[model samples]
Target: MTDFLRRKLIQAAGSAAALGPFAIGSVSAQQKGDIVIAASQPITGIFAFAGTAMNNGLNDFVLWKNANGGVAGRKLRYVSEDSGFKLDQGVAIFKKLMASEKPSFFYGDSTQWAKAVAQDAVAAGTIMTSSTSLASSMADPTGMPQHFVPGPIYGSMHEILMEYIAKTWSKSDKPKIAYVYADTEFGRDGIPAGKARAEKLGLPIVTEIVTKQAGIDVAPEVAKLRRARPDIVIFQGYILAPMPEFVRQMREAGLQSQVMGTAWGLDKPAYDALGAMGESLAGVSPYRYGHETDSTMINAMRDFGAKNRPDMKNISPFYISSWLSGMVFAEVADRCIKANKPLTLPNMKAALESMKEWDSGGIFGTLVDLSKHQAPVGRIYRYEPKTKTMEPASSWLKV
Candidate 1:
């Protein structure tokens, strides 16, 4: 193996050791210094909007850590690559990230690609945290400890959102519902899961529609949904794909539904693209920028935005969530260093496993219950286009 892949395998294996009592072997001086991290994201293709924000968030956290005196005298050095939201590209990047770049951990670009890379990352013994807040085959209980999803899974969020709709319009005559999604594994995962939950709640699912990534040729789908005169419509797709186009076309076609989206669908760029029509669109999201009370972290984000991305006005919830993920990783790294554990994957994973009810000072309050190797806690937020912001929709949702 190349030097970089060797380091990645060691880091992943170390994380497994942390889960148990296994001991990790030491590395030479070259791979023995600072904790190196990498992120692979969609910067040029369908997932670009969210991917760009996630990358910026990762970079910002590393800068913040370095400015704050570094994590235990070892500054975090992070890198990111654009994968274009292609599965082949994603697989290739993982091979490179593992075999050449040698990062201690990786943050996934999207849910679809997360599934593709998690297996390889696990086999290589490296830890990967995903912003793809969807439950999938990768979330199977038998999976290894290579993955961490610190947000409300798509299946769970869909159930709750459907329940909320049922309760909110309970007094009215039976309300019809419609579902629109992309034509991908990530999209297909939501259909069965949402249908099962909606049926369990006795909510009538009137129309089910799917569209491709190229553009919104969803007129036929909308016509079918309009025939049902649905009261609720849920979209499962990406910010840069057919979602905004769907909203615009559906609205222009004079078919109005109480439109909401899955976790990945809502963000500032999506809202901006849809213009005034975006007002009716809402969805479940993982983080909120203005809701933060951690003056330290919030101020840092504000300063960074002002200095670097002044034109990018609204820092969406996912952006903050991505930043928080890196912060949590840094905290784990700090713990491992304080304990004199080597800053490899195994030691860092061990430190994370040791944490319980970690108060990430302000922006994060979820308990890191690693006993089951799952992020057992999350929160839900709703967006308001009038304000162009996401507000807390519920208290922390826990498993």
Candidate 2:
């Protein structure tokens, strides 16, 4: 954090000590210092908006964490490469960084990168990894033991939405749900699991719509959806391009079906681009929005952006996701250091898993548990265009 932000925080909290557990501490360095957190971030390409924000969030967190006592007396040092959101490029960056930096924690760009580097990370044995992905497959402790998700898996997100639909449906017949996703790995990842969850709840999957990454016509897709007339439609594997058009066209077709999305889709840009129709979009979110007051951590994030990134608007969900990853990294390293254990993969993995009812100081409204490699709590939120915020539509749910 900048000096101005630190001074402002202290003043806001009344005293240095009044800032509580997350308050800044003496900048004195320990003998064994500089815990490295490296990343192959997608700062370019399709996910640039999210990637740029995520990188900024992590960088700011490192600064803030160092100012706040440096995690067991060791200051954080962050290094990153812009992977351009390409899998091969990301993997190569991971290799180069691992060899050069020997970081204790590494954040990946995508599920492909996470999977590509998992075995190598395990072989390194000195690092644990995390990413923006909530792919259910990444949650396996045995298969991807050294990797952890910052939130619930995508399947769990779909199930959470289904649960909400089931509980709120007032008709005699079960509500019809449709899954509209892209053909990318991320787009197809959760469909099977989501279908299973819906079947388990006795709800019907009326239709499943698939789209390509680009150059696809939505008229046919909308016509197909109009025919299905699903009571609810859940979108996956996209940031913005087609969703706003789909929502608009669907509305024009005189369909009143509610639209929903998962984590990445809930970012501010996606909602803001939807204009007046944004209010109709609702979905599951694992992290608190930066503007929300309940989380001290979130408030601090906003303060950092305000003092540092003056031109930046509201903090995006991707920013919170990466910020949470930094926190998790620090917590794991802190645990290992306090116990006099080496910051090896096994040690960090154990430290990560042992965190039951872990308080992220406010990122999560509910206490977090990473034992399953996933923080299985999420809340339903609908965008309120009037306020330009995603207001909570339901209480927190753990699946």
* Candidate that would win on lDDT: 2
lDDT of 2 by residue, 1-399 (tens): 235434433343343234333333221111156889999999999888879988998999999999889999879999999999999999999999887876888998888898898767766556789998888888887777788998888888888888887787864788888889999988987788778888988989999999997777899999999999998888998887788888889989987788889888888767787656644688989878878998999999888888899988778888898999999999998997787666666667789999988998778888988998899888999888778788899988888
Worst-scoring 10-residue span by lDDT in model 2: 22-31
- Candidates' lDDT values, in order? 0.65, 0.83
Q: How close is candidate 1 to the true structure, as a TM-score?
A: 0.79
Residue 55 CA displacement from its true place in model 2, Å: 0.9
Candidate 2 stretches with Cα past 4 Å from truth are 1-31
Error of 1 at 219 (Å): 2.3
Best-performing candidate as measured by TM-score: 2
Cα displacement (angstroms), candidate 2, residue 316, comes to 0.5
Query: 108-176 in candidate 1: lDDT tens per residue?
Result: 776666666655665555454555445655444235345556555566567667666656677457578
